[model samples]
Target: MATEELNAIEIEIARNRLSSIAEEVGSALIRTAYSPNIKDRRDCSAGLYAPDGTLISQAEHIPLHLGLMPTMIANAIAEYGAENIREGDVLMTNNPYIGGSHLPDVCVISPLFYDGELIALVATMAHHVDVGGIAPGSMATHATEIFQEGIRIPTMRLFAAGQIQSEVLALLMMNIRTAEKTRGDLIAQVSANRLGLRRIHELVDDWGVDGFHRACDSLLSYSERRTRAAITKLPDGTGTFTDYLEHNGLYAAEIPITATVTVAGDQVTVDLSETADQVDGAVNCSYAVARSCAAYVLKVLADPTLPSNAGLTRPIEVITRPGSLVHAEFPAPVAHGNTQTSQRVVDTIFGAFNEFTEHLVPAASSGSMSIVTIGGIDPKNGTYYSYVETYGGGQGANPDGPGASATHTHMSNTKNTPCEVIEREYPLRVERYEIVRNSGGSGLYRGGEGLRRSLTLTRGKATVVAGTSRVATRPWGLNGGGDGGPARVEARTNGEVRELESMGSLQVGVDGTVTIQTAGGGGYGEPEAGR
Candidate 1:
């Protein structure tokens, strides 16, 4: 039967099944992964795509990684001609210039076949702890160029014809600092794709191949219809808002990210042309990252219940200046771009969207990922170490109630490194982990509060590099609400305590303590009656 012949019930079933398959792939990778970053924090995403690289369904994962897979798949197919890719061949890449958010995020792509015909692509993007850069964690805060951030892997086959490429594995292992962990995570990704392929075959067996494809197409069209309907309800006008990054890693000057949202009939355009130019730091992001951020805001503001696919991005257009902070050129460092700038982009978009309709959008969120990278040697085990993580912050308040506290939001959805896992795996001790009272903004429905976590090194000395935002400016509240508290970081070494800048590098001696307090979310409505 033709794709248009698929009924609504049949299309919904098929669409949900495809999403389940993507969820299964993510579950398998998280269960068998080696690093805490993947297994504990779950910094990964899985999705299924059409042969032409149109997104079909994606597991509920990191927003930054979700929207970039289609582009990456197209790049992979371009590098290795479509005719060269086989059923069992798997391609991998982490080059930001080639549809990637950053260097540490390695993407794996596997093509699926049914009855000797190419049907779909199973892909996943996972954040590895290390990818062999100047810094131990591969997230150098002061890096001036992309090369200094980490090794850049171009589109290439890691597995061919159902067999692992030994030389390719060796080269990858040789470059990264954590060879064993990286290898295990890569294997986990491969396993996840294979599992997805097996599940797809089962799905095809249940519903004929043609029926399955038709259902996918129907689902895409349905989502597009729902999104357009939602868009038509908004007023036809322009809403503009600007957000600032605390500073790029190389300087103390504030960086601006502006968004102008135009709603005309049933379409919206997010223009970022007036934003700051690319800086000489590690916070510059690719156009892909900018698109992901804008797409996320539109998806949330629109019908979020609609299945996420290419359809959600159909009515939205994201335009960025070629050499702006949100669309950096080649050789620019982007280690912190995926984590830092992406959050600001989300805030800027939402700020603009709120002007169009006050009740539709929530208050500003924490507006930063609060990335901390530590690397050193363990004196007892003599093992080189690199630890990368981001702390959780508060969520923005809605019209109905207060926001949630100590959680991930927007472009970043990574879980915090559990104290037990950190103490067991690394030479560090979690001295204190608790919520900071009154950090949330004061309003009728107050925003969520941030958290405080202190860590002490127990082994050899280590170098710590951190990139954070919301220090110079607080998270903005909506309507008559109050702004949220800003984030802060400090280090206490050898009885001398000093506050650290938003982005900087420092040395932590054995027994030195580092404390970080994440930012709170913005409030909504007027202040409450008392306190």
Candidate 2:
């Protein structure tokens, strides 16, 4: 066989093997994780990267973490250089400033070695149940500083020389409310990494490492070429768009996130510098998180066929001003930036792109629909439980297809823990869980609808928490499409509703009935026009 043929074959083998490695890691995480967050809801991510900290491939994971992997790996190498790393060492961190989105999404880094030399890294990050913060579940929308978000673990070794770092593990276990579960997930992350390392070795044995290395590089180069071609197809011009966050939950001020999108010679630059400054709430975001959001949006709206490596990000440059809403400062709260601001950024970009390529972008989605966690025990068993569920609204209608109903459109790939799983795990009973039909806007492509779920406590008392939006400014439609409705929660004592608008953290208790009413998405083109 020709040398070129061998090289090409080897690279293809490596690329395929890398995807296989991700799948293995994801399976191990799902099977081992104890929390519904990881097991059922799948609020987790796993990926493989080259030795130089370039993301090669990711398992079927969320968009937020897929693009953010390079930053996470880059920080891991920055904190602990290659020389300091040992064979069994696994690093972990959740610092947003230091290449992370939020504290809840913890990144576990493991170095992979072939022929006794570091060739790659395997990583897995999950939304931990708790990480010791001002809030019980670390949703800390009230947080004014990074300290209030959750535990900040700089890049540190979870395992040193094949042995668990007991000191670090013990300190982490002692913090969160779900200590036992966190410990298991922590070790499970390493186990998943180990599994990937083993699979890579198997691939190396089948074919020489030379081919595998070539394949990784080829995959990236191919992706870059494809992404550049996609850029060339966009209309060459500059367009600006703006969108607003209802409030910082203060009923005080409405901040606007703006994007000036310039497409020049097959390149796009999204500048968010004109956006508003950081406000008094936890709505601020780190530069890495902001870029990650931009990257995610482009990947979704532009081309999912691209490799999603540095190559794909080459044609796109995201600019944000420091201390602005996009670039948050120290001691400034930013937990909601990952969830709330991410959607706003996407919408802003969509709004900009809508002018250039109207048919490409859809209407705005029901933004910021995160899970509300409320759980604890009275006198029954003293075994406190933490329960959280994601509530979603309608997705905006598109020119071709109507939006999905009662579903999380973007930034929400998680699933609601099943009724059987909820009952088996905690002292709770799901009374009502169904779609809120006809809530969609009337249009050519009817907008997606929202959902309504009711849960009743079978036990004594359980605390429930929530962080959702689209209740204030409904989803906006494109062309003449209609808007998505509002979103709110309801708590009842003896079947009588109590609070209508509340962000329940650990302050509220649920004894009997609790119902949550979510919103729907907006329509796209005018129904009459399309007709």
Candidate 3:
């Protein structure tokens, strides 16, 4: 049947069925994974794609991961020809230059076949705790180049012909610190893809291969039409804004990220060609990351409920200069770029929209993920343990109401690692976990409050690394609202308590405590007259 002949009901049913499969695969990964980062924090994402690499459906997981997964899959197929891909073959890679967010975010791709013909593809991307880098969690703040970050895996066959490649797996295990945990996470990703394959096969069985293809084509066309209509609703104009990264790990100077948004007719263009050049620090990101941030911002302003697929990006164009902060070239470190720099990109894009677009853009939130990584030997078991967690902050207030408090915002969509799980899994103790009251800005509608979390080492010493932002720069409020509070990090030793930089590492002795206070969201409007 022709795609044009498919009715709205049939298309809607296919969309829901495919989306459910993606969500189910994500749940399977979270339930079966061994690491707390995946099982508890849920730092993984799942997606289904067409044979030509167009994204069909994605789990409502991390925005950063979802936006970049399609590019990664396309790159993989380009390098390793689709003709070379066969049933039971799984491809994997984490090379930032080859369409990846960071070295630690490993992606596994599996091609599904129906009756000896390539029908669909299923993939998953997860942030492994450690991938053999200068820092324990593979997110080295002071790293100068990608080589120092971690093991860079290009597109290769992790599983070929329904068999596990032992030598290939061994090579990866030899480079990282926690081999067993990494192995478990990798297997979990593979298992999730297998589940996706089975579900897709079942779908093909119900609707013949040709009918399934037609439904997918119809869905794509519907989403594209919706996106274009949304774009046409915005007033045609161009607006530009610039935001800064507080620190670039090696230096304390702010790095600028600029976004120029132009909405014309039924399309939008985001130009980042004038942004700062890539720095020596780990604050630089790849083109894929830049594209993802721009795509995310457009979706928020245009239509948040639009189906997340390749069609949604058809009306958006993101342009970045080579070697710029947003589009880093080869060898530049990008560990912090995926977390810290991505937030700045989102802020700049939204700030630009606020300048001209009639859409009510919210004030800036905490503007940071506040990632903390601690790696050490567990005194109880004498084994190496790597703890990775990203803290939540206040959400920016919008026209509708006040921003939500102590929540993950923007590019990152993840849950905090529970205190009990943290204490039980690693050699750490939670000393304080509470909201920093009054940290949010005051306006007619107040911004959300930030949180303060402190952790103490239980037994042995460990290397603690903190990567955050909004330290020197406050989250700017919209219209007449007040700016939000700034983020702060402190380390306490036996008798001395010293403040730490936004992006740096420190050695914590036994009983030492590291406290992180995230920034609050910006207020929505001017405060009411006070007595």
Which tens-of-lDDT digit does each residue in 1-531 have in candidate 3?
Answer: 455546889778988999999999999999988899999999999999987779999999999999988888898888999999989999999988877999989999989998899989999999999999888888889999999999999899999988999999999999999999999999999999999999999989998898888888888888999999999988898999999997988979878888999999999999999899999999899888888998898888888998999889999899999989888899899998988989889999999888896537989989988899999777778888899999999888887789889999999999989999999998899999999998888787788899999999988889999988888888988877888888999999997999988989998878999999999999978788880
Q: Pick the candidate with the highest lDDT.
A: 3
- Please report how far candidate 2 places residue 382 from its true position, in Å: 1.9
lDDT score, candidate 3, position 450: 93
Superposition error at 160 for model 1 (Å) = 1.1
Which should have the higher TM-score, number 2 or number 3? 3
The Cα RMSD of model 2 versus the native structure comes to: 2.6
Of models 2 and 3, which has the larger lDDT?
3
Cα lDDT of model 2 by residue, 1-531, tens digit: 123432456555655677878878988988888888899988888888887678888887777777677877787787778888888889888877766777878898888877788888888988887787776667766666778767888888888988988999989877777787788878888888889888877876775577666666677776677787887877787779988887564343578999988888778898999999988777777777767777777776668666666667777898989889888777677777767777778888888888777588888887775567766654466755677666777888887899998776676677778889988887777898898877777788888888888877776765566666676678788888888777767777665677554234434444566777777788887787544
| lDDT of all predictions | 0.87, 0.76, 0.90
Q: For candidate 3, what is the lDDT?
A: 0.90
TM-score of each: 0.98, 0.94, 0.98
- In terms of TM-score, the best-performing candidate is 3
How does candidate 1 score on lDDT?
0.87
